[model samples]
Target: MFQSTAPQRRSIPHGRRRAALWAAVVPLLVAAPIALTGEAQAATPGTSVSYATTCTPGVVPAIHGTTISEITVDNATPKVGDTVNVTYDVTQPASGNPTSTALPANVILPTGVVSLGGAQTGTVTVSGTRTNPPVPGNAPFPAFQMTGSFVVSNPGAITLSPGNYNINSNYIISLDTPCTIDTPPAGVSNTITASPATVPNNRVITDSPSSGPAGTKVAISGSGFTAGATVTVAGFSGTTATSDVTQATADASGNLTATLTVNAAATTGIIAFEGATYTPATASPPVAYSVTAVVPPGGSSQTLNSSVKGGTLSMTQAGSTVTMTPVDFGTGGSSTGALNAITVKDFRGGSSGWSLTASNTNFTGPGGSSLPAAGLSWTPSCTTTAGSPSTCAAGSAGAVGTAGATLASAPAATLTGGQFAAGANLSLTVPAFTAPGSYSSTLTLTLA
Candidate 1:
């Protein structure tokens, strides 16, 4: 048996002395036992003592709370090298009492985003922790606070893209989406975002020949807009009357061309024009379109010698109205006399034809006495030339006789292709017994 010395010194061999030291150290070492999670020692002789002293954290938290309350960003759509502020909310586990870890939340980085420089941490709020279950207690210490910022490396590419990232490294969450955190205490969701985004410089409009008279057809065109969109072209009529005259569908390349009919009565001035998309409609600034009044080509006139050959008459147009000299019959002259020759020249762009007609077949004068229809005659046939054509034989005086009846001139005057000419000859017979001081009759030549 080995004995220990009590304040005693003795001479012994070196090998024996070494054995004695070993014997003493062995009992003390055996007396102190190292437990997996507690301290163990012999306190009083044979009385054993054991209690928890320090905690050894395992690889993971004991009770991992899966709920992530929120994740906020300073700039959701950041350009390359643009610092983005981020914040997260998550409940930390209770410490010392047996719960989870106290690491603050973290914001995951999106692809193509490289951290450059920014505030790496934000103020953190921790839920009160308890070590005594349902009893008053305090949280022992703080776990590592997890916070940081990510900056964009390629700004041009990163902008206008969704923030698709996570709130922590352990979860595959999205900043733009409500993420479901799947940990022990599951069924918790997280959300994140900052600003909205859109593309720019995508539309234009133009019109050809911006100014014109009423009824002019204008061509409207556009490009650089959303493809496959329906565009409506409206012409400004007044402050309130915006008439939409044409509609076009955009092609895949975002181009369109259409024609619009300007109202014949549209007000003259700067006419506003606009092109717009129907779906999620947007409009280009109103462009000015000039409207002008139509100017007359100017009036023309012509005169003709009366059938009396000696007398004459003339025709003229004032504005849109036409006037002609009155036919005159001399007092008691020849038993039979001719009236006059009327002619017409057409210069209308429509190139339409016209006809002439007489209101009555005879003449009436002072005493209400009238001349016989047979006394009145005319050559209805006309031609593009100033004189009658060869086919106008029946047009001779007394040739086309509807005895005692009315006569309407025919063989329409026309602007054949471009222009036309026509003439008319009238004849009358005077009864010797026509009791009158001066004779007069109304002859209306309606030229249309």
Candidate 2:
């Protein structure tokens, strides 16, 4: 069985608190699509609208014209159930009486249609301060931008058209100013595509030979991890506190493979293997492995001495002692070479495991000028011989300094006694200020 955790909501930026308040209101208006009315009259700088206002509760509302432009959606890629900010530019034409003033505004957004079929509706709330001239004059209101937040209810194309916007006022008394839009500006509405929500922490980890004796080799695999991320494989005994852990890097396909052997000290119990990232935010379902103890022969109450023959364990390389391309850094500060295919044969029958390591000497130039051994780095890789049951793994990439580095390895249980082919992309770095001359270095590979 698999379990999933809830995804956390995205945090909004500071100073955009108005959008947050509208998020709570947009979801409630997701019923049938609301149809808009009226036809295009005369096109304005933005969207033209006729405004009817009342500065006093008992007085008749005044009339004016305004345009709304610069409609924008903050999120380029919105997802269903996500809260996004939609902003608009409004410019009021000179008109309201000497005591009229604009107040906080609220608007219903145009119905949105999902590409996959379905309609979504929402609203916007303007929370910015609404006080500027005309408290008593004939000047046009300054152009300003208003922003509101809305929850994306569906996936697909969402077009925001001109809608009913209400502007309140406080001119010695509370008043309401309702505005009606006649038509939307040509190609002025912003369209945003909302995608389907993604599943959170979805991953699967599995292993072969789930039930085995101590020293049994198991091949473990994981998928749905972040690409190029390191994945940790952990094992815990069901009946004991004993545990083990190993790591492998996920490939471009977000898949990982590793080999682990049941610990020798492990007692008969279930060994659960789980895969997770470095942060370990989430883990895949445990792949249970049963451990069975090896039984000894029983006899009639008598003591007997017995000896078991140990098998041979060793590594042998085919062809030359080492296979590397000759490097010629012709007038160069840096260059690269390749470590040709060099197969290492591990005939160690049921042995714990083996590691192939490499180190290098400093490149010696004419007259003995030298480049640091650390300048030589490599991206190591390895593959099991064809038809081989062995699962060979490449070690992490690193420089081949005097201290050396593991180039490749195979876990104890992963190999049924076979050959491992190893190679690497070699890079050589030389200081720019170094004297121009031919340099040479020796690389040594060892199996342990």
Candidate 3:
């Protein structure tokens, strides 16, 4: 009877609702077993998963919070002309054995970011391990760690768009977990210089009195010369003349002057002036002057008689002597004979008066000597055929007079003829009472 009452009309919808609930609950229950199993599996020691990932294309990965770090390059973000670098590290948890392995790193660039040239790239590895092994082998427990890295170079960041760029590196690491990456700040550098040479001034030299008489003054002039400049002249003969004779300092205007007396005996030669050192044919050319010495004419001396007979008389009987002497006409006249008169005799005709004449009155001598008579003569009449008064002709003898009457005492004379008698007769004779007055004559003497 109790069982029959139990069936007291339960609603089908409630049963259905219960059934759906059971269904849902049963699956949850089933899933619980699997979840627990998985959790247990995860909790077991030595559980691990491969750690590696490709880096963003064309970008370099940065490092953070870990001791070990590394970078690598791969195809993930690969671009025809792009390069990238990545770094990885670990944080917390230590590992007994640490190892680093290569990981995929990639580089990529926008069409305009990279040029057609090949991209520059590099790679690196990082690793760290705990000092002690965990327990001994069963399975070496790894310290908390991380791996893999990527390097990427974005051409967009290059100085010029579509220009080649470089990817620094990629990295892989062990013994460090939860690693982060950071990009290092970029570095820049640069350099500079200068240019040129030197400059100089011009020089000039001049000389005065381009030409003059020997022993003349010569002045050396220099213009546009340097200060403390040295000057020289060549072709100098005496001590007064020298190869480097003159020297001077330039004035404010770079002008200089030097005065010197040229040697009177100097021969014609080139006069050269120069700087500290001889510079032949320089702008300041050397100057020279033609010099000449004046020479005077030589002189001679002669003697003549005061009187003689006839138009001409024998030089032998003229009672006149001649001597030769050398003289320097340049200086005025000079004589070396004592004053005296020579005598001449004429044997001409009646009580007629006769005149005596001589030629060349002045004479000079280094020593006393009788001068030569140019001529001796006497005129028969006071007047000559030409109606002119008779006069002694050159190199001729003239009138005769009484001996001693026309003669004067001879002073001491040193004859170049060696010597003469102390009382040598220097007398002439004429007709008695012939005109009576004294007649004068000239004589000339020459010496070697």
> Total clashing residue pairs per candidate?
5, 3, 66
Instruction: Please state the error at residue 249 of candidate 1 in Å.
Output: 2.3
Model 1 lDDT tens row, 41-61: 100011111111222234333
Output the TM-score of candidate 3: 0.21
| Candidate closest to the true structure, highest lDDT | 2
What's the lDDT for all of these models? 0.32, 0.49, 0.25
Off by over 4 Å in 1: 1-56, 59-84, 89-139, 149-196, 264-281, 297-448
After superposing candidate 3 on the true structure, give the runs of residues whose Cα lies further than 4 Å from its correct spot: 1-201, 233-244, 264-276, 280-283, 297-448
Clashing pairs in 1: 79-155, 80-155, 81-152, 202-224, 307-340
lDDT tens digits by residue: candidate 2, 287-403:
556666556778334334343322333443332322223333443344665664566665433324556776554455665345555677789999888765568899888776555
* Clash count, predicted structure 1: 5
The TM-score of predicted model 2 comes to 0.33
